[model samples]
Target: MANRWIRPEVYPLFAAVGVVVGICGMQLVRNICINPDVRVSKEKRSSAVLENSAEGERYAEHALRKFVRNKKPQIMPSVNTFFSDSNRD
Candidate 1:
């Protein structure tokens, strides 16, 4: 009966939405537990601010930038090692 509304063609769309929602859920959970500024207690929630303060600098960085900020683009980690003999072990 339920199969009448559901189709195989819609499976990919469901998978994509599930992935997106899962990523967002994980991010939210991570922020709540790890970020100092994210107040779990009701009393502290009033004082919470979205913008970065002095200490908030660490937590305020966007997810993409936080990872990519210090990371230099490397086509492959072993590319240079493979080409260079002096550095090879």
Candidate 2:
């Protein structure tokens, strides 16, 4: 008699599934980050460009403050929270 539960063929199937999932995740990240227009509206893009042209640092600081103020009270945390916490830790 031999053990029947540990199938040798299962390893390859799991590996293939993992690769597929990784590829899909990479595609999603690429789409989101590499293409800002996908997520940004026209008004937002115009404002960002205007802000970046004349006083870039000041604009960035103001934008950051506004973003933090708007999102701090929301139920879900913003992406900056993750970045800020990671840098501090």
Candidate 3:
């Protein structure tokens, strides 16, 4: 008996739909990575010029230091256990 539920003619349609869906998924991921929210916030903050007063200068310095610290990649020590030395390459 022939499989009537999934006929040969519908294969092309399924393939086209799959391609379109895959393209859409890839575009979404690209959009998320290429256009991030952190950049927007950075731009907004940059436009706001800090005051020359001592308080404003101090605040700006603190903010700059915090930003640098946060952006730096954290290096964590490897796990320590009796059975394994995780630090070994």
Candidate 4:
């Protein structure tokens, strides 16, 4: 009777596939936007991959790394430390 329908049990499989596809799409788009030689605009098109490490690093540096470079490394205080420290002040 069903011409085109997925079983309900298969929904999770489809969801996982969708998530992987989305992640792959984001990576492709990010590469296109960030890569030096992969120019999108016609006026400033590049012929080959640029061998500029400095430029690549500028794009590749993680935001968290930059934020933590001048600060401490702890991302969050432990729950025990938070409760104990709270009582002191």
Candidate 5:
């Protein structure tokens, strides 16, 4: 009586049908959720530097020069010199 529910011979067929149905359902859901109309377009923005006048440019340049002068130069050791004792010095 327990075996009468789904015949053993038809098990593979049912599995195949279930797989196909699941794939189709997933595709349908994806299409519905990921439609082009559902996406929001981002607006293009302009930079403050682009909108500045001549006087603003001079002030910005002066600030940048001061910043550059205050920052210490970074020395990175060469990778090839890592193994050689003489090259490291």
Candidate 6:
């Protein structure tokens, strides 16, 4: 009689467990490695730049308005002649 190490049915279960464990471990490592100090510094800088200066706020607003205006589609009239003398008094 030959000794079999792994049953065929258990192989898929092991693979599934391995995949779940790997994903969990990767997420744990990423959470641990992320720098909170860098995030805080970036947030402070952004808020300071955006909220501190009136000129900067004006520039940002102007830029945003310009961007929105530029993104709008231009509507051209399909009719060639503007003046249609149909009901002239």
Estimate every model's Cα lDDT from 0 to 1. Answer: 0.78, 0.62, 0.60, 0.77, 0.60, 0.56
Best by TM-score: 4
Q: Could you give candidate 3's per-residue lDDT for residues 1-89 as a string of tens digits?
A: 55876899999998999999999998777555443322345555575554446744553466559777755353443332333675555
Which 10-residue window in model 6 sums to the lowest lDDT? 31-40
Query: What lDDT does model 2 reach?
Result: 0.62
Report the Cα lDDT for candidate 3.
0.60
Tens-place lDDT digits, model 2, residues 1-88: 3357557867788899999999999878866664433445656665443423444444345645967775556565666577668666
Better of 5 and 6 by TM-score: 5
TM values, all candidates? 0.51, 0.38, 0.37, 0.54, 0.36, 0.35
lDDT of 4 by residue, 1-80 (tens): 55357778888999999999999999899889886657888765644556778977887686867877886556665765
Pairs of residues clashing in candidate 6: none
> Please, what are the lDDT tens digits per residue for candidate 1 over residues 1-89?
87986889899999999999999999899888868777888887887465546547656776778878886687675776688768566
lDDT of 5 by residue, 2-85 (tens): 688778899999999999999999877755554333323333123213343664556446655977786556454454446555
In model 5, what is the error at residue 51, expressed in angstroms? 29
Clashing pairs for predicted structure model 4, backbone only: none
Ranking by lDDT: 1, 4, 2, 3, 5, 6
Which ranges of candidate 5 are over 4 A from the true structure?
37-89
TM-score of 5: 0.36
Q: Which ten residues in a row are the worst by lDDT in model 5?
A: 39-48
Q: Candidates sorted by TM-score, descending order? A: 4, 1, 2, 3, 5, 6
